[model samples]
Target chain A: MAPNGVNGSSGSHRFDPDFTRLVVENMGPNVAPRTRQLLGGLIRHIHDFAREVELTNDEWMAGVHFINSIGQCSTSIRNEAHRVSDILGLESLVDEIAHKLVVEGDVEPTSSSILGPFWSPNAPFRDLGSSIIQDPNPKGRVALMHGTITDLLTGKPIPGAVFDIWQASANGKYDFQDPENQTPNNLRGKFRADENGKYWFYCYHPTAYSLPTDGPAYKLLQLMERHPMRPAHIHIMVTHPDYRGCTTQLYPKDDPWLATDTVFAVKNDLVVDFKPKEGDPKATLDLEYNVILPPKDYKGKL
Target chain B: MAPNGVNGSSGSHRFDPDFTRLVVENMGPNVAPRTRQLLGGLIRHIHDFAREVELTNDEWMAGVHFINSIGQCSTSIRNEAHRVSDILGLESLVDEIAHKLVVEGDVEPTSSSILGPFWSPNAPFRDLGSSIIQDPNPKGRVALMHGTITDLLTGKPIPGAVFDIWQASANGKYDFQDPENQTPNNLRGKFRADENGKYWFYCYHPTAYSLPTDGPAYKLLQLMERHPMRPAHIHIMVTHPDYRGCTTQLYPKDDPWLATDTVFAVKNDLVVDFKPKEGDPKATLDLEYNVILPPKDYKGKL
Candidate 1:
């Protein structure tokens, strides 16, 4: 049942049809039920795929090498594996299915979205209403974002809610993605809701960007002849001891490729307007949104 | 649709449920039909699996890292991906389905097994009845293996049929798998059937051995609580301009893992006896196998 091991012969011949059942049933009892289920399902689907194509050794080898290349393309900051998942729409489906499970009760929390590979866990911590702009001179108009965190069921603000925020500069690159041109953590920071459950920050507006095209993941897109564009968006994650944490992205209302998002992270509720602001010299654009956090013990959704 | 990219938006919100159809339908027309079918099937299955498990973000991240690890664990000689395929019984099922496509008519060629990952295409050539044991002395009794090549339908001899043969040494290590202890090409060679369609060679008998226990593949086995031992096998591949090529393994009768070959490669006809022969010092053991090669244009089973 191990990935490197094979078959169900006790030193004798093995039958073809019986092989699948044997492989799945032979997993030792020590395997956790969840592991057994996951691995069992995986093995069945893999076998089905091979049989459907009558896959040959050459094709098998091709698959093996591709899997390895995806792994090789991954790094701490860039997950090529996640990219493959996205390309295959696995990530999108998971996002949707996970959210639906949470929206079970009448009081539905805000839909969750994928965190994506650009999230920086170590972004600098900043005070409320401060700018995440790390570069002295940054591109794009200044955009102010403010949001409140409240319990979904009780409609009460949750104070001290943690938030991790990150976005691409107008040039369409994250700090680490364009290390030579952008300072580390540029337009990226961590903030917490105040006593009033309000948190605010400012950063350069976002723009549509192309995914990395230099890796095996890109080769897959080329094979499918699918384009590799993601619309402009800001990632926001909120967490607190009393509430279920959420990781999501807020999409600007005007970029192209929304319906054809390669990862399927978009939801109507998560889309908001970044209107042009006037009076305040510090802000060229302003937006406001609020999050409905579910309770921590909620055996709810994604 | 690149791996590192996500979503479709003209810069607006996206609705759920429409994602899968959009993603698939959006693939460019340039994608080859077979590529489309294979990739499309893969995408659907991957999405289905993720939803079946209601997979979580942590689980998804774990999968990404695991995929990367499999690639990192692989090399030119060791295919952890193939090992994983074998573990899931995909290799075995593929073998069965391919072979079935060939057994359409009454005349059937030999069964094809997995080529496995240890094959070296550049083995030294050996004369009929020559020894693959390059070392002056070797472990295990000498195994004298001789085989005849003939057309499955005509039952006629096929001369000059090429054969690539390899097997683990007495210590259960292929040359590359045990570089420090085994000499290059130490029980491996290539040969051509004589005008009579007969080919023979000798080598130190093989023994059951463990798969590499130091990689991700091995980790999978641990999770499944499966042993890594493989039944002793002699890798044999035969090809000719006039016939369909076959890559298979001959299981030595009496090996304990025969029924449960880690790769599920064992076949009844492919299992042969290595009987003792006391007459000449060069004939400590003997084996005879006749290969039935189908025509090169054969639209036969594997």
Candidate 2:
């Protein structure tokens, strides 16, 4: 017979509903309301998912290991896990999904994405018509980019909008993540548009690059037998206190991997032509970027 | 109009199904069959969970942070995150539910709980008739414990089983984690049963204690509004060269926390009575214990 405990408190082994009750009864007494709500929703979702999958022990442990490696691979130069997020298109889908909600500026679309592992606090400021490129060591043809940022409805430029841009060099490397390159900042700079919402910059045509395939995310990809390439693009973060902040990338027209960018950041409104200037002594390019400010007196914002 | 890329690649962004596809596809390469199967299944479960909850960006980031704190909370004496697991009952549920499926052998009829963060590898081995207590602290009335390891089918006692027992003092502190009290080996030991499947030891009755709540797990629980207490119990890791391994615990009968053990470790067959025996020399002692052996022909198989 199964052993019995004092006062007959222990009897047949049975599933206690206590687990569910305990969890609900014990979480978050001091958290902010929004955070509490978010955590509560997350716990519910995770629990429901576990139930739906009937996840096993080994499988759960594997998730633990995968997450562990994500932590290990997070360095100043690389965030392999974030790269995985990009490859999965989580960053693009959640942050860059343009909708009526965003265009109407019902919610302030703060720049959101993986905060890619390579970002640093040191970004030198440049003028409206300044060249961001320093030491043009493996330089390609120079291109001049111009854009007019205006209120979507009024077609008026939101002068003085700060435009931050960075891109892969012709050799497919960002200045921060690559250590072999010089340190003073290359292919990355911040620019301000003039009062007319007009601006231009001198930089080489960006090239396509492969996401890092040497870390745990790579191990994961190898385990799944998948590719690790992203389309050619220039990374940009557009921000101002008044208008919604936008973190996006502009994809080049002729990159072979455009359709398969590991981060899935290509957005139609964001992509612009990097036209080749014909013997005009200058590579002139022009595009219009509109910013829609949040409406006055509206409170339910993102 | 939605702008198009020069190469005519559609830049229109939407939440693509390809995101989920890429996540599963890029996990790990050529792992063990069992590992691959497990990770693959888990990835699917996490994905489904995220979708079912319509997981938002903010919520997902919270999960990442929660996990990060869990890792941060891990130390030599505390692992509150695991306690969070215990409080959620995931630890006990997993231990009891899926352990056999992954590795099967001598199944212990008793209930098992989490391996709390305090167990140390330096426990001093004690002989059969010795007290587990070395320090004069957390005193409780000593009582003799006796039992026979018999087969449920045959009702025959099995001899030569080794039973390892460890528990906190009456004050709820394990020796190693408590620096204010005493030296290394205190209130902890291991005992082996004789040919009759019988053994005894010395120690006061274990008392319930709150789990470590000063770390990140505590912060999480505070956020979750939960307590950090576990019911009184004695851990038993029973093994014999020929019998199946059983790592379990015996909880006290009248524990107030029985219904609410933070780690969800209460099992039905695992509870044992601490009867107050009639006035005898053994009854006045500081500690007393007993043991039972495994079945014959039960070679230790993992």
Candidate 3:
């Protein structure tokens, strides 16, 4: 009876009247009626899952051990476990699926995936056109990315849309997760769009690389017979007060790993070519992008 | 995807590649090939159940809140929450269904029901035949309880079976939970059988009563149109090295609530009768009794 107990039909053998009793009794005194109903549904779903699997003692123990390992692997600077959660897409699934159900105008704050073990909350904010080089890894061809944020309905520019961007170094290492990376804020910065809702940043082209293989997600990838490679890209979270936030990635043309990215994060709209400009180096670096934002009235957040 | 990602099929859409990705990414590392097969089967069952119910968003949130409330309500002194769990019968269902899967020679400890909120872990032990009347109230007819513990298979007396027993006071109140009744530890005691596995105790008849209606279980009862009555009984936990430990209740005949106990704890084999001795008040104080334990080879203890 996985968390969506209503539709779940299996696990009836294991579904004692007690499941309902435990849920309701333990719900405590202060819970709202709506919350209680929600919880009861969830218990059914979780129980259904357990029943569907006819979960064995050994398997249950393994799950406990797995969760314990996730905690153990989390550290001050690295949260391999969190990245594993994100790569699995639970954060996005929960956020998007839940958001889709919410009605207009009363949406909760959208919580984007916080990729674990590979991000720093305190990365420095830099102005547009500033370089995002951290340390001495061989830099690739420079890319100048320009983009506009506009309302999806009116096409009106949304000035001050904040862009929080990060990318792996040339060696596929993040500053906080990799001690060998020397840049204090390697390849990570926050920028606000100008009055015209346009902004640009300068950074070396990223190279496709595999996620760290030493962590739990890597081990899971191997067990699933899946690859761990992500297409070369820059991660971005775009936000404005009157618009829904977007967490996305931009991949370059013809990356070998694009089609089979381990995270399933590649969408058609996010793939763009860095069409090289002719002759002058400055011309060669230019890139222009336009992103349509969900309007204020849409109000789908989670 | 309650806990195990089992709800993929619950939605109107069939599982897409995204679902497969979720399966591969969320399953833990080191999951054996066989385990994956088993998990796959389970997930299908879970998804089926979800679709059957067409569970809604608000319902799912209710379920989540319900689980969270269980954690919040749990504490050392009282597990009224567990009472609710027991009423649901999930506790017993899980115990009975899982019991058979236990491998020989690898039995775990006697997995008790969710510890009810009233246990103190420090009940005082008393001698055989001692009365539990520190402060008797609304006394009923006196009954002499005598019992000899013996192996079910060999019919040999177990010399040192320990008996921990508790019951509501004559007026149907347990000391700990009944604030209006008495102080703590009043109607509970532990005793050991003699070499012949014989013991006796003087106590008044117990009356069936309802569980607390001031909590969420009560609200649930209202929602489900159910009552909160239990059969008149005494709870007993018996333990010996040669056999499995058993926690059961001794019910009195002709009790109105026997068949419809809120907790669903009654078993025909556990019923008992109290014979009234009608001679001199002190004469024939001793009564003969016998308890057939489970088979000696029963592998339920650690």
The candidate maximizing TM-score is 1
Worst 10 residues of 2 chain B by lDDT: B1-10
Order of candidate numbers by lDDT, starting with the best? 1, 3, 2
List the global CA lDDT of all models: 0.76, 0.57, 0.60
Native A-B interface contacts kept, per candidate = 0.61, 0.20, 0.08
Q: Where does model 1 exceed 4 Å of error?
A: A1-15, A102-107, A136-138, A178-185, A194-196, A298-302, B1-18, B102-108, B177-184, B194-196, B300-302
Instruction: Tell how far residue B100 is off in model 3, in angstroms.
Output: 7.3
Q: In terms of docking quality, how is candidate 1 classified?
A: acceptable
Query: Taking the tens digit of each residue's C-alpha lDDT, what string does model 1 give over B1-302?
Result: 11111221111122244555666787898899888877766665565456555677677778778888898787776678878878777777776765654355685687888877778878998898799887534566787888799998788999999978998878787788677777999888999999989898887667789888898877888888787888988888899998888888888899888876766778788888888877868868888888888887766443
- In model 1, state the lDDT of residue B198: 89
Residue lDDT tens for model 3, A178-283: 6766567888888899999998887767778887788766776676666788788877788888887776677887788776676666666677788775675543
User: Mind giving the per-residue lDDT tens digits that candidate 1 earns over A188-211?
Assistant: 888889998999888767778888
Cand. 3: chain B TM-score: 0.75
Query: Candidate order by DockQ, highest to lowest?
Result: 1, 2, 3
* Chain B TM-score, one value per candidate, order as shown: 0.86, 0.79, 0.75
Query: How much does each candidate deviate at the interface, measured as C-alpha RMSD after superposition?
Result: 7.7, 11.6, 7.8
Decide which is better by DockQ, 1 or 2.
1
